[model samples]
Target: MTPPETQGQGSNAATPGASPAVSLCVSTLQHRPDFLRAASALRQGTGGFLLQARDRRDDSPATRVGFTASKKIGNAVARNRAKRRLREIARAVLPGMARPGWDYVLVAKPGVTTIRDFALLLADLQGALARIHKP
Candidate 1:
């Protein structure tokens, strides 16, 4: 029920010569044990949040990440917002800097993660990652 010319002109349609977007393959950590292990391994604190990382030392080559916001952040809505910010920062920064077979957890700060400037949050994550991976 659509004309040919308009059929392929949807917003998501790729341009004729534009290269496809390249997205890194990253996994989410869902197990409590995984988070606990990472917590016990390495920790880097930033103004926005706490970054915890652990090398799984397994055969898997995927980088896994987790986000957490405690009740101290506020009620449900505030906690969710903090976690959302953490997830976004992880998504943007982890792909390039995170090592394979590593698990990372981003814990939201009570007053920072939900309201901090986005660029600063990005820098915070990047710096934390650098310090964590340093020898």
Candidate 2:
């Protein structure tokens, strides 16, 4: 697959002059049942976010991810901002960390979801995924 178009910082494409890693085919988990499945699977919480991941033992060749922010996080704008930050971090990190045929959900926490430093948030996510996937 040609690299996905970059909107800004978290571009899906590999940087120039670097050989690309295995391309990721990630899908969005939109159905309620999908999210429910992830909710019942392995979970890891970091300082920045909560991650839930499940093996979707089906024939699909792509990993799926979902994002959610509770109403208590804030009003619509704040919730959206938190979700957007989660999405960007997923875009940048999931290709490297996520396994195919798994469903992952990212739930935004209250204060750190939006205001935390991006690099730290990325590290938190990477750490969470590592812990979740460990044998």
Candidate 3:
């Protein structure tokens, strides 16, 4: 994930094409193992540099997003919590912070999902996205 400071930048202009509002959200890791595997292999394409306001893709119509959490976070409970937290973030910011044809992979930070304040977590994630997805 990008640092929280940058999330706000991407929060705008992230409409149906470049906005987060139109991005797809998937919470269940089991629903798409193939996609999970593919996502795991993803290197930082454009290193989040592609989202920059200056270099941002002007023609893209959608964004693709993926998430990953390893066994290190904890048992099923811990992992699930992390994903849940991330889900909330995607639901909150993705709708308003991303562009179309964007594929985002929200990797779980250590103990991230375990945090009880989901709203805070979501804000942090949004802020980070804004920072990372900058021009």
Candidate 4:
């Protein structure tokens, strides 16, 4: 007899009657209407960013995120910096916490968004998402 098959016995393989691990996927919202719609749902604030969430009542399987910074934040350099911070925090926090068919808008807050500590900013995004998705 040939050697017992060990190729299917590794930890990564799904055992009998065991469910496989699911991967989280996130996407970016592009259209103007998408941003307009997400503005109407839940809103949460932290020291770094303001988060707005809207649940799209559809059959999509990915979460969508958006970022925005206002002129009030500052000149071109400051506005871009704030947007960059928001984008980084969103990428770090949104995948696992954000549910499918949801749209999230991260608006930069002047004097706070760019200067906030990176760890705190990440935590803020996570906390805001927790509150928004709470039942």
Whichever of 3 and 4 has more lDDT, that candidate is 4
- lDDT for each residue of candidate 2 in 1-135, tens digit (9 for 90 to 100): 878666643646556686665448988889998888789989999999999999888888799999999997899999999999999999889999998889999999998898999999899999998998899
Q: What is the lDDT of residue 128 in candidate 3?
A: 61
On lDDT, the candidate that comes out on top is 2
Candidate order by TM-score, highest to lowest?
1, 2, 4, 3
lDDT of each: 0.88, 0.90, 0.54, 0.86
Sequence-dependent TM-score of model 2: 0.81
Candidate 4 lDDT score at position 120: 93
Task: Give the alpha carbon lDDT tens digit for every residue of 36-114 in model 1.
Answer: 9989998999999999898889998888999989899999999999988888888788878889888899999998889
In terms of TM-score, which candidate is strongest?
1
Candidate 3 runs further than 4 Å off:
1-60
* Model 3 worst lDDT window (10 residues): 47-56
RMSD of each candidate relative to the true structure? 3.7, 9.3, 15.6, 8.4
What is candidate 2's local distance difference test score?
A: 0.90
Better of 1 and 3 by lDDT: 1
Compared with the true structure, what per-residue lDDT tens digits does model 4 show for residues 1-135?
Answer: 876658777576776885553337677788999998888888998888899999888998888899999998999999999988888877777767889988899999988888889999999998898888889
Please estimate how well model 3 matches the true structure, expressed as its whole-model Cα lDDT.
0.54
